[model samples]
Target: MAASAYSDHPELCVKDNFKQSNFKRRIQVQCDLLKEDQCSAFTAISHSDKAIILSFRGSEEDEVTMEVVDAITVLPVTEFSGKAKVNQYFYDAFNDLWNAGIKNDFLSLKNANPGYELWVTGHSLGAAMASLAATTLVTTKIFPADKIKLVTFGQPRVGDKTYAELIDSIIPYAYRVIHKNDLVANIPPQFLYGYHHHKSEVWYNNDMTKGQPYLECDEDESKKCSDSVIDLSIPDHSMYYNVTGSFASNGCKGWNVFTQ
Candidate 1:
């Protein structure tokens, strides 16, 4: 597909006027895993369309932060226990993002384009937060039903079937792209509650460490999974977004879409 196929909507990629103090505040947060050596390297840059991109480097890897055009929310990931608290924390984090966008200064940017859509996305833990944030916005009617969407890479289950059902009932378009052999998504925290959820497509691959290029599943691999599952093994967990674009571009609308 041509690069022009993807609409460069203003709200999808907006920039933020970040100050030096924001970095200080990020470091001050005691519980945040983003803490590092002497200097706190976290930075939030707003895209022209209004979405905020937060980038930071940890001891071994780097992390990217996301904020939608109309919603400049942060992920409140304080704990990891499998409880309603995890759900509520995600809810609060998303609410904060919504509040950020509508705040006095943030409102000016949002009102500049009333037709803009709010989106949240991430990779790894960030992807998990994106899923939670999207669910919260839809459940609370924070944004239009179909207008909100989520694009996550290697996301895990947020809650039980009830939570998934709540998310499915409200959000019309949510896509979770899983790379082949990505063990993170397989953890299945929500499945423990008897809430079985599957992906729209499982982009698999032979080696994820190299480039993680995406590939369609062979006939044999697809049969190993039940009809309930779409085993994507192309990208092999790491390189889900290949040169051909991510799984989202291939039309995997997720379990929420087809079920409804």
Candidate 2:
């Protein structure tokens, strides 16, 4: 679904993704892509399996970072009762997208699919949005934390230690998938900026190919995993699961178009 999020027409790309997968049953792509100048996401559902997916699209470096460079300060989030502080830009971006439209579409999807599991994912900047989205869903009582599964790739630090722990405690199944030395994963220079990632870092020790070795570090920003890499490379950030493209079905290693 993360790959599907990149398409101009997600409804068609997602169906193409499902068709290419191993599942015996297909998912329902109920809407077009959720896109804006700064962020984008796509939603799909499998009624038979009682599951829903919200996949956010990665952004170009220049476009996403511009929002951060100007609003680099960290601020206490109102939703967390001023307890957890986060990058003001990340916070604003999430709220802007949520209040603008994603919230209503999400709520409607939930109401229509009772007992369905929520699976959220993204890459790069989209990873930031996905992190906030999952946390918001739980904080707003939209879904019990346990019912949501969040797995992001090349995820940067979303907040400070307190905020990371809050996300950790709430989203137990969260996993930040980092390719070996993904430059984006080391953003804000860690402690220098007081930003930290959440727990369970899934690090692919080598090139992330079908049979490559990987590790799951239970500590947030674990030094024992991807954090251990001394040399960081930006190119590594764009090739999750061994696919190579900017941020679409092409990145997932295959492409096809179908009329909806």
TM-scores for every candidate against the unseen true structure: 0.49, 0.83
Q: Please provide, for model 2 over 1-260, each residue's C-alpha lDDT reduced to its tens digit, 9 standing for 90 to 100.
A: 66666666566555544543222122222111323345666667756557777777766655545534433444434447665767765666666666666677777778877888988888876788799999888887879898899999888777788789899888988999999988778875665557788898989978876667789899987889987878988779877776643445333335422222
Each model's lDDT comes to 0.38, 0.70
Q: Model 1 over residues 1-260: C-alpha lDDT tens digits? A: 11101112211212112121111112111113233211111222233433423221111122222212101123223232332223332344334434443223323433454655555555544455566656554555545667665666655554455455555566666665656565445434333434223333345444333444544332211333222244533234344434222322333223122133
- Candidate 2 versus truth, CA RMSD in Å, comes to 6.0
TM-score of 1: 0.49
Best by TM-score: 2
Q: How much is 1 displaced in model 1, in angstroms? A: 18
Task: Judge candidate 2 against the unseen true structure and give its global Cα lDDT, from 0 to 1.
Answer: 0.70
Q: Each model's number of backbone clashes?
A: 26, 0
Model 1 clashes, total count:
26
User: Residue 70 in candidate 1 has what lDDT?
Assistant: 9
